[model samples]
Target: MKYNNFRKAVSSLTSQRSDSSLPVVALLTGLAVGAVIGVLFAPERGADIRTKISDKAKDLSDAAKDKLQAVKNKFHSEGHELADLKDEVVDKVKSKARAAEELKDEVIEDAKSKAKDLADDVKAAANEVKNS
Candidate 1:
Protein backbone atom coordinates (compact mmCIF):
# COMPACT_ATOMS: atom_id res chain seq x y z
CA MET A 1 0.00 0.00 0.00
CA LYS A 2 2.00 2.95 1.04
CA TYR A 3 5.23 1.37 -0.08
CA ASN A 4 3.64 0.50 -3.41
CA ASN A 5 2.42 4.06 -3.78
CA PHE A 6 5.89 5.37 -2.90
CA ARG A 7 7.48 3.04 -5.45
CA LYS A 8 5.02 4.17 -8.07
CA ALA A 9 5.75 7.80 -7.28
CA VAL A 10 9.47 7.24 -7.66
CA SER A 11 8.96 5.38 -10.95
CA SER A 12 6.78 8.16 -12.25
CA LEU A 13 9.43 10.79 -11.37
CA THR A 14 12.25 8.72 -12.83
CA SER A 15 10.37 8.10 -16.05
CA GLN A 16 10.52 11.81 -16.83
CA ARG A 17 14.34 11.83 -17.11
CA SER A 18 16.79 8.96 -16.62
CA ASP A 19 19.77 11.31 -16.24
CA SER A 20 18.17 13.48 -13.52
CA SER A 21 17.87 13.05 -9.72
CA LEU A 22 14.28 14.24 -9.60
CA PRO A 23 13.14 10.99 -8.02
CA VAL A 24 15.61 11.30 -5.11
CA VAL A 25 14.75 14.93 -4.51
CA ALA A 26 11.06 14.14 -4.70
CA LEU A 27 11.50 11.29 -2.25
CA LEU A 28 13.25 13.52 0.28
CA THR A 29 10.62 16.16 -0.16
CA GLY A 30 7.90 13.60 0.39
CA LEU A 31 9.55 12.39 3.59
CA ALA A 32 9.79 15.92 4.95
CA VAL A 33 6.20 16.63 4.10
CA GLY A 34 5.13 13.39 5.73
CA ALA A 35 6.99 14.27 8.90
CA VAL A 36 5.33 17.66 9.05
CA ILE A 37 1.91 16.09 8.54
CA GLY A 38 2.52 13.51 11.21
CA VAL A 39 3.59 16.14 13.73
CA LEU A 40 0.60 18.24 12.96
CA PHE A 41 -1.71 15.28 13.47
CA ALA A 42 -0.12 14.10 16.74
CA PRO A 43 -2.61 13.20 19.47
CA GLU A 44 -1.00 15.37 22.16
CA ARG A 45 -2.30 18.88 22.62
CA GLY A 46 0.01 21.66 21.37
CA ALA A 47 0.56 23.04 24.87
CA ASP A 48 1.39 19.64 26.27
CA ILE A 49 3.85 18.97 23.50
CA ARG A 50 5.48 22.29 24.05
CA THR A 51 5.86 21.59 27.75
CA LYS A 52 7.32 18.17 27.05
CA ILE A 53 9.81 19.62 24.59
CA SER A 54 10.83 22.33 27.06
CA ASP A 55 11.26 19.81 29.86
CA LYS A 56 13.41 17.59 27.68
CA ALA A 57 15.53 20.59 26.65
CA LYS A 58 16.01 21.55 30.29
CA ASP A 59 16.97 18.02 31.28
CA LEU A 60 19.50 17.87 28.46
CA SER A 61 20.84 21.26 29.43
CA ASP A 62 21.28 20.19 33.06
CA ALA A 63 23.02 17.00 32.03
CA ALA A 64 25.37 18.96 29.80
CA LYS A 65 26.13 21.43 32.59
CA ASP A 66 26.89 18.63 35.01
CA LYS A 67 29.21 16.98 32.51
CA LEU A 68 30.93 20.29 31.79
CA GLN A 69 31.48 20.88 35.49
CA ALA A 70 32.93 17.42 35.96
CA VAL A 71 35.32 17.95 33.08
CA LYS A 72 36.36 21.34 34.48
CA ASN A 73 37.01 19.85 37.91
CA LYS A 74 39.07 17.03 36.44
CA PHE A 75 41.03 19.50 34.32
CA HIS A 76 41.73 21.69 37.35
CA SER A 77 42.95 18.75 39.41
CA GLU A 78 45.10 17.48 36.56
CA GLY A 79 46.58 20.95 36.09
CA HIS A 80 47.81 21.02 39.68
CA GLU A 81 49.30 17.55 39.37
CA LEU A 82 50.97 18.57 36.13
CA ALA A 83 52.48 21.62 37.80
CA ASP A 84 53.92 19.49 40.59
CA LEU A 85 55.32 17.02 38.07
CA LYS A 86 56.83 19.87 36.08
CA ASP A 87 58.61 21.21 39.16
CA GLU A 88 60.04 17.81 39.95
CA VAL A 89 61.27 17.38 36.39
CA VAL A 90 62.82 20.85 36.41
CA ASP A 91 64.67 20.08 39.65
CA LYS A 92 66.05 16.85 38.24
CA VAL A 93 67.21 18.59 35.07
CA LYS A 94 68.92 21.33 37.05
CA SER A 95 70.69 18.77 39.22
CA LYS A 96 71.89 16.87 36.16
CA ALA A 97 73.05 20.07 34.46
CA ARG A 98 75.05 21.06 37.51
CA ALA A 99 76.71 17.64 37.60
CA ALA A 100 77.59 17.88 33.89
CA GLU A 101 79.13 21.34 34.37
CA GLU A 102 81.24 20.11 37.24
CA LEU A 103 82.49 17.14 35.20
CA LYS A 104 83.41 19.49 32.31
CA ASP A 105 85.43 21.69 34.63
CA GLU A 106 87.28 18.72 36.11
CA VAL A 107 88.20 17.35 32.68
CA ILE A 108 89.54 20.72 31.55
CA GLU A 109 91.71 21.06 34.67
CA ASP A 110 93.07 17.52 34.29
CA ALA A 111 94.05 18.18 30.66
CA LYS A 112 95.87 21.39 31.63
CA SER A 113 97.77 19.61 34.42
CA LYS A 114 98.89 16.84 32.07
CA ALA A 115 100.08 19.35 29.46
CA LYS A 116 102.13 21.25 32.04
CA ASP A 117 103.79 18.02 33.24
CA LEU A 118 104.69 17.07 29.67
CA ALA A 119 106.23 20.52 29.09
CA ASP A 120 108.32 20.24 32.24
CA ASP A 121 109.61 16.80 31.19
CA VAL A 122 110.58 18.14 27.73
CA LYS A 123 112.55 21.01 29.34
CA ALA A 124 114.39 18.61 31.65
CA ALA A 125 115.27 16.35 28.69
CA ALA A 126 116.68 19.28 26.71
CA ASN A 127 118.82 20.38 29.66
CA GLU A 128 120.22 16.89 30.06
CA VAL A 129 121.08 16.70 26.34
CA LYS A 130 122.89 20.08 26.52
CA ASN A 131 124.99 18.93 29.51
CA SER A 132 125.99 15.75 27.77
Candidate 2:
Protein backbone atom coordinates (compact mmCIF):
# COMPACT_ATOMS: atom_id res chain seq x y z
CA MET A 1 0.00 0.00 0.00
CA LYS A 2 2.80 2.40 0.82
CA TYR A 3 4.50 1.65 -2.45
CA ASN A 4 1.26 2.26 -4.32
CA ASN A 5 0.72 5.59 -2.55
CA PHE A 6 4.24 6.72 -3.32
CA ARG A 7 3.81 5.80 -6.95
CA LYS A 8 0.53 7.70 -7.14
CA ALA A 9 2.09 10.81 -5.63
CA VAL A 10 5.03 10.70 -8.02
CA SER A 11 2.78 10.26 -11.01
CA SER A 12 0.60 13.18 -9.99
CA LEU A 13 3.57 15.43 -9.52
CA THR A 14 5.04 14.37 -12.85
CA SER A 15 1.79 14.86 -14.77
CA GLN A 16 1.79 18.50 -13.78
CA ARG A 17 5.10 19.04 -15.59
CA SER A 18 3.93 22.10 -17.45
CA ASP A 19 4.34 25.58 -15.97
CA SER A 20 0.61 26.01 -15.47
CA SER A 21 0.63 28.00 -12.22
CA LEU A 22 2.03 31.45 -11.50
CA PRO A 23 4.98 31.73 -9.16
CA VAL A 24 2.86 32.58 -6.14
CA VAL A 25 0.34 29.81 -6.76
CA ALA A 26 3.04 27.24 -7.32
CA LEU A 27 4.85 28.31 -4.18
CA LEU A 28 1.71 28.07 -2.10
CA THR A 29 0.85 24.64 -3.38
CA GLY A 30 4.34 23.40 -2.70
CA LEU A 31 4.30 24.75 0.85
CA ALA A 32 0.92 23.15 1.57
CA VAL A 33 1.98 19.77 0.26
CA GLY A 34 5.25 19.86 2.17
CA ALA A 35 3.54 20.81 5.40
CA VAL A 36 1.03 18.01 5.07
CA ILE A 37 3.75 15.46 4.42
CA GLY A 38 5.86 16.74 7.29
CA VAL A 39 2.93 16.53 9.69
CA LEU A 40 2.09 13.00 8.66
CA PHE A 41 5.63 11.74 9.04
CA ALA A 42 6.76 13.86 11.99
CA PRO A 43 7.28 12.22 15.40
CA GLU A 44 7.06 15.58 17.22
CA ARG A 45 4.02 17.70 18.14
CA GLY A 46 1.80 19.65 15.69
CA ALA A 47 3.54 22.87 16.77
CA ASP A 48 6.35 22.19 14.33
CA ILE A 49 3.99 22.00 11.39
CA ARG A 50 2.24 25.15 12.49
CA THR A 51 5.52 27.01 12.70
CA LYS A 52 6.50 25.87 9.21
CA ILE A 53 3.18 26.98 7.76
CA SER A 54 3.53 30.40 9.33
CA ASP A 55 7.03 30.84 7.88
CA LYS A 56 5.83 29.76 4.43
CA ALA A 57 2.99 32.26 4.55
CA LYS A 58 5.41 35.05 5.32
CA ASP A 59 7.60 34.10 2.38
CA LEU A 60 4.62 34.09 0.04
CA SER A 61 3.58 37.54 1.23
CA ASP A 62 7.05 38.95 0.56
CA ALA A 63 7.09 37.44 -2.91
CA ALA A 64 3.73 38.97 -3.78
CA LYS A 65 4.87 42.39 -2.59
CA ASP A 66 7.95 42.24 -4.83
CA LYS A 67 5.89 41.35 -7.87
CA LEU A 68 3.49 44.25 -7.21
CA GLN A 69 6.38 46.69 -6.88
CA ALA A 70 7.83 45.57 -10.20
CA VAL A 71 4.50 46.11 -11.94
CA LYS A 72 4.22 49.58 -10.40
CA ASN A 73 7.65 50.54 -11.69
CA LYS A 74 6.74 49.48 -15.20
CA PHE A 75 3.53 51.52 -15.15
CA HIS A 76 5.37 54.58 -13.84
CA SER A 77 7.91 54.40 -16.65
CA GLU A 78 5.19 54.15 -19.29
CA GLY A 79 3.30 57.08 -17.76
CA HIS A 80 6.35 59.30 -17.92
CA GLU A 81 6.90 58.42 -21.57
CA LEU A 82 3.31 59.30 -22.42
CA ALA A 83 3.59 62.66 -20.65
CA ASP A 84 6.76 63.50 -22.60
CA LEU A 85 5.09 62.70 -25.90
CA LYS A 86 2.15 64.96 -25.03
CA ASP A 87 4.48 67.84 -24.27
CA GLU A 88 6.30 67.44 -27.57
CA VAL A 89 3.08 67.42 -29.54
CA VAL A 90 1.80 70.56 -27.78
CA ASP A 91 5.03 72.43 -28.47
CA LYS A 92 4.87 71.54 -32.16
CA VAL A 93 1.29 72.76 -32.42
CA LYS A 94 2.15 76.06 -30.78
CA SER A 95 5.06 76.61 -33.21
CA LYS A 96 2.85 75.95 -36.21
CA ALA A 97 0.21 78.37 -34.94
CA ARG A 98 2.80 81.15 -34.47
CA ALA A 99 4.08 80.64 -38.01
CA ALA A 100 0.54 80.87 -39.43
CA GLU A 101 -0.13 84.13 -37.60
CA GLU A 102 3.08 85.69 -38.96
CA LEU A 103 2.19 84.69 -42.48
CA LYS A 104 -1.27 86.25 -42.17
CA ASP A 105 0.20 89.54 -40.94
CA GLU A 106 2.67 89.70 -43.84
CA VAL A 107 -0.15 89.14 -46.39
CA ILE A 108 -2.28 91.91 -44.86
CA GLU A 109 0.62 94.36 -44.90
CA ASP A 110 1.31 93.67 -48.58
CA ALA A 111 -2.32 94.32 -49.53
CA LYS A 112 -2.38 97.66 -47.66
CA SER A 113 0.80 98.89 -49.41
CA LYS A 114 -0.58 98.02 -52.85
CA ALA A 115 -3.83 99.91 -52.14
CA LYS A 116 -1.87 102.98 -51.02
CA ASP A 117 0.23 102.96 -54.19
CA LEU A 118 -2.89 102.78 -56.37
CA ALA A 119 -4.46 105.79 -54.58
CA ASP A 120 -1.28 107.87 -54.99
CA ASP A 121 -1.27 107.19 -58.75
CA VAL A 122 -4.89 108.41 -59.05
CA LYS A 123 -4.14 111.63 -57.08
CA ALA A 124 -1.11 112.48 -59.27
CA ALA A 125 -3.16 112.09 -62.47
CA ALA A 126 -5.93 114.37 -61.14
CA ASN A 127 -3.38 117.13 -60.21
CA GLU A 128 -1.86 117.01 -63.71
CA VAL A 129 -5.27 117.43 -65.34
CA LYS A 130 -6.04 120.48 -63.17
CA ASN A 131 -2.71 122.12 -64.09
CA SER A 132 -3.31 121.55 -67.82
TM-score of each: 0.59, 0.52
- Residue 45, candidate 1: Cα error in Å is 2.9
RMSD of 1: 7.3
Instruction: Report model 2's TM-score to 2 decimal places.
Output: 0.52
Q: In candidate 1, which residue pairs clash? A: none
Off by over 4 Å in 1: 1-39
- Model 2 residue-pair collision total: 0
> For model 1, what is the error of residue 32's alpha carbon versus the real structure, in angstroms, after optimal superposition?
8.7
Residue-level lDDT tens digits of model 1 in 5-35: 9688777767775666876777786897787
